[model samples]
Target: MAKNKSKKKYISGSLLFLLAFCFYMVFGPGRHRHQPKRQDTEIKNNEAKSSKDNTPLRELTTFTGKVTAIKDGDTFEVLFDGQPEKVRLADIDCPEKSQAFGKNAKQYASDLCFGKEVTVISTGKRDRYKRVVGTIITADSINVNREMIKAGYAWHYKQYSKSKELSQIEDEAREAHAGLWADAHAQAPWEWRKEKRTKKQQVSNQ
Candidate 1:
C-alpha cells in the first residue's frame, strides 16, 4: 500500500511539473517575463474602456424614430422614446474629421439610421454630451455597426469593440476588404485625435 501511494505521489508531481513547463513555454517566463508598454496598446486599452463606459446597461426601452438627422459615423438624433435624443453607437469607431472617408462614414450612417426606427440595446452610459451610447438593431436584426462596415463605409474599430458579435462581423468586413479596408492603414478616429493632441503638445513645447 505504501508503494502504491508513493507511485501516485510521483505521478502527481510529474503532472504538476509538466503543467508548469507547458505554461512557461506558452507564456514565456524563460528569461525576461516583462513586456514593455506600447503607445498603441495603451491607446487600444483606453478606447476599450471608453467603449465599455459608452455601451448601454440594458436598453431601458425599445422604440422607433425617424432619423431626423445623422451627426457622424457614430452619432444620430432621432425622434426616439417620444423625444429627440442623440445616440452614439457602442463598440464601433469610424474615421476622424480630417481622415479620408470621414464624410463617407457619416453619410453611410445617415443612410442607415436617418429614416429608420432602430431597436436600441443598452450596455453603457450617456456621455456628458448627452449621447445615448448603445447598440442599435433594426427590426430585421440588422446590426448598424456591421452594416456600416459591410457597406464599405466604415472600418471595424477592434480597439473599442468588446462584443464578440461585432468583432466577428468586423473581421468579415476586413477579410472581404470592405470600406476603410480599401486603405492599407486607415487611422481610427480615436487614434487620429490622440495623434493630433500629441502633435499640438509638441508644438506648444517647441
Candidate 2:
C-alpha cells in the first residue's frame, strides 16, 4: 500500500507540472509572440490619422487677404492675417517703371486691387525674389493677372507659364491694339530688362 501511494503521488506531481507548462504556453510570455503584429497595426493606424489631420494645410492652395500696397503692375504687398506679405502675380510680366506704359500698368493694378479684399490662388510656387507667386482675384471675381494680360498691361510670360487661356487673351489684346499693344514698338518686360542689362555691361566695359 505504501508503494502504491508513493506511485500515485509521483503521477499527481507530474500531471501538475504538465498542466503548468501548458498554461504558460497559452497565456504567458510565450503568447506574446503575436503581440508585435498588433503593435505594428496600431502604429500604422496612428500614422494614418496624423496624415489625415494635416491634409488640409498641406493642400492649402488659396487664401484671402487685403491688398495693402501695389508695388507695381505684377507685384504687390498684401495684409494677410495682420502681416504684410509680398506677392508676385504668376504667369505674367508687366512693364518696368522705366518702360513705356509702366506707370499706366501700376495705376491700373492699383485701381483694381489696392486696399481691397482679394483672393490669392497659390500656384504652389515662389519667385526668385521670395515673393509668393499666384493668381490674384479681386472682390468682383476678376482675375487680376489675366486681366492685366488681356488689357495689354502685361505680357503672357510664356517662358514661365503655359496657360492657353492667358495666351488667347493676349492674342485678343494684340489684335485689338489695346493698351500698350497700341504702340507699334511695345517691348516685352523681359526683353527690356535684358537690354538694360546689356547697356549696363557695355558701359562697364568702357
Candidate 3:
C-alpha cells in the first residue's frame, strides 16, 4: 500500500509539470499574439495625429511681408520678418538695363510692390543670385507679376514657372500690343543678356 501511494503521488506530480509547461509555451516571452494588436493601434493613432497636424487650409508658400525696395522690373527685395529678402518675380522677364523698356519695367515694379505688404509665393527654389523667385500678390489679391505681363512691361520667361491665368494674361497682352508689346522687334531679355556678354568678350579680346 505504501509503494502504491508513492507511485500515485509521482504520477500526479508529472501531470502538473506537463500542464505548467504547456501553459508557459502559450504565454511565454516568445509569444507575440497580444503585442501586435497594441502596436498596430499605436501606429494608427500616430498617423491620424500627423495627418491632422499637416492638413492645410490655404498654404502660403513663403512668408508675407512689405516690399521695401524695387531692384528692377522683375526683381525686388522684400522686408520680411526683420531682414531684407531678394525676390525675383517668377515667369516674367522684363527688359534688360540696356533695353528701351528698362526704366518703364523698373518703375512699374516699384509702383506695384513698394511700401505695400504682399504675399510672396515661392516655386520651391532659388536662382543663381540666391534670390527666392516667386509670384508677388498684394493684400487686395492682385498678382503683380501677372499684372506686369498683362500691361506689356514684361515678357513671359515661360521657363522659371507659370500659372494658367498668368499665361493667358501674357498672351492677351502680347496680342493687344500693350506697353513693350508696342514693339515686336525687341529681343527677349535672355537673348539680350547673351548678346551683351558676347560684346563684352569681344571688347576684352580687343
Candidate 4:
C-alpha cells in the first residue's frame, strides 16, 4: 500500500511539471521573442518614410502651371496660380536670338511645352531678371532642361550646375552632331554674352 502511494505522488508531480512547462512556452519568453521582430520592422518602415520625405526635390514646393510663352530654349513664361511668371530653365543656357540655331531652339521649346501644363520645381530662388530659376517637367513627364541639352539646343551651363547626367547627355548629343553640335565652332551663350559686354565696354570707353 505504501509503494502505491509513492507511485501516485510521483505521477502527480510529473503531470504538474509538464503543465508548467507548457504554460511557460505559450505565455513566457518564447512568446516575447516575436515582439522584438515586430518592433524592428516598424522601425525600418518609419526610417524609409523619413528618408523619402527628406529628398531634395520633395522638400521644394512644387508649382503647377501652363506654359504661356517660350522665351527661348531655356526660358519660358508660365501662367501659374492665375498669375504670369517667367521661369529660367535651371542647368542650361540656350543661344541668343541672334546666335546660330537660336530660332530652331526656340521653336523646339515651343513645340514641347507651349500651351502644355507643366510642373515647376524650384528652390524659391530668382535670377537677376526676377525669373524663377527652376526645373520644368511637362505633362508628358518630359524634363525640359535635360532635353534641351540632349537635343544640342542648349549648353549644360557647368559653371552654374554640376549635373553629371546633363554633361553625359550633352556629350552624346555632340557625338551625334545633333542640332547646334553640327557646327564645329558653336559658341556657348555665356561666352557670347561676355563678348557682347566687352564690345559695349570698349565702345563706351571710346
Candidate 5:
C-alpha cells in the first residue's frame, strides 16, 4: 500500500509540470509577437509626424505696398507694414544684371513700378532667398508680370507656371522680336546661371 501511494503522487506531479510547460509555449511567443507590432505602429506614426514637420506650409497672400526698390527685372523691394519686403515676380525669370538685355529688363521693371503703390498677390511661396513669390499690379491696374513677358524681358518660367495667357504673350513677343528676343540666341536665365556655376567650379579646380 505504501509503494502504491508514492507512485501515484509522482505521476500527479509529472502531469502538473507537463501542463505548465505547454501553457508557456502557447502564450509566451504570442505575447512577444504583439509587442513588436505595437512598436512598429508607433514608429510609423513618428515618421509621418516628422515628414509633415519638414514640409513647407503654403497659402495665398495679398497685400498693397509701395515699390521701395527695384532689385532686378524679376525682383524688387516693397514697403509693407513699415518694412521693406523683397518680392520676386512669380512665373518669370529674367536675365541677370550681367547678361545681355539685363539692364534693359531692370529699367523696364523700374519704369513700370518704381515709387508706385502696387498690389502684391503672392502664392505665399518663398524662394531660397526667402523672397515672397507673387504678381505685382501697379496702381494703374497694369499686370507687371504679364508686361514683362509681353515685352520679352522675362521668360514664362513654364516649370513653375502653366498660364496659357503668359505663354501666348511670350509667343507674341518672340514673333515681334521684342526685347531679348531680338538676339538670335537668347539663353534662359537658368542656363546662364548653370554656365556661371560651371565656370566657377573650373576656376576653383585650377
Candidate 6:
C-alpha cells in the first residue's frame, strides 16, 4: 500500500510539470513574437516620416505677367495679380553683381523683357529667398534662359537643368568667346558665391 501511494505522488508531480511546460510554450514565445511586429510597425512609421520630409513644397505651373524689375541676370520681379513677385530664372546662373560680365548679363536681360509682358513657366518651387523659380519667355517668343547661355552671360547650371539645347548652346558660346566666355579664366557664378560666403564666414569667425 505504501509503494502504491509513492507511485501516485510521482505521477501527479510529472503531470503538473508537463502542464507547466505546455503553458510556457504557448504563452512565453507568443509574447516575444509580438515584439518583432511592434518593431516592424515602428520601422514603417519612420520610413513614412522620411518620405514626407523630402517632398516638394508645391506643384508645377505657368504664369504670365509684366516684367516689372530686373534684380540681376537670373532674377527679376514680375507684376502678377497686381502684386510684384520675385522670379529666379531656371536652368541658368549668371555672374554676381561684382563678378565679370555681371553688368552685361543684367543689361541683356533688361533689354529682352523688362517692362514687357512675358510668360513664366514656373516649376512652382520657391527658393530660399522665396523667389519663384522658372523659365521666362518674352513677348517675341524668345526663351530668355536659353539666350543667356547662348550669349555666354550665364552658365547652364547643370545641377538644376538637363536641357540638351541649353548645354549645346553654352558649348558653342564658349567656343565662340561670347560675353563672359571671352575671359580665359572666367569664374562661374556659383563658385563666386561660394567664395564670398567662405570669406564672410572667415570674417565672422575672426
Top model number, lDDT: 5
Checking candidate 1 for backbone clashes, the offending pairs are: 55-123, 55-124, 56-122, 56-123, 56-124, 57-123, 57-124, 59-122, 152-179
In angstroms, the error of model 6 at 94 is 0.3
TM-score of 2: 0.70
TM-score of each: 0.62, 0.70, 0.67, 0.70, 0.71, 0.70
Native-vs-model 5 lDDT?
0.93
* Per-residue lDDT of candidate 3, residues 77-128 (tens digit): 8888787888888888999766989999899888877899999999556778
Q: Which stretches of candidate 2 lie over 4 Å from their true place?
A: 1-61
Among all windows of 10 consecutive residues in model 3, the one with the lowest summed lDDT is 53-62
Q: How far is candidate 2 from the true structure (C-alpha RMSD, Å)?
A: 13.6
lDDT of 2 by residue, 1-206 (tens): 99999999999999999999999999998689889989999999999999977653222258788999988899999888877778899999999977999999999999899999999999667667767889999989999999998888999999989999999999999999989999989999999999999999999999
lDDT of 5 by residue, 1-206 (tens): 99999999999999999998899878878778888899999999999999977765334379998998989999999998787888999999999999998999999999999999999998687888878999999989999999999988999999999999899999999999999999979999999999999999999999
Candidate scoring better on lDDT of 3 and 6 = 6
Error at 155, model 5, angstroms:
0.6
lDDT tens digits, residues 40-135, model 1? 678899999999888753344445666777878878776765667777777777776467888888887876667887777764467678677777
Alpha-carbon local distance difference test for all models:
0.74, 0.90, 0.85, 0.90, 0.93, 0.91
The segments of candidate 5 whose C-alpha lies over 4 angstroms from its true place after superposition are: 1-60
Worst 10 residues of 2 by lDDT: 52-61
Off by over 4 Å in 1: 1-61
Sort the predicted structures by lDDT, highest score first.
5, 6, 4, 2, 3, 1
What's the lDDT for residue 12 in model 4?
Answer: 100
Name the runs in model 3 displaced over 4 angstroms.
1-61, 162-164
In candidate 3, which residue pairs get closer than 3 Å at backbone N, Cα or C atoms, i.e. clash?
none
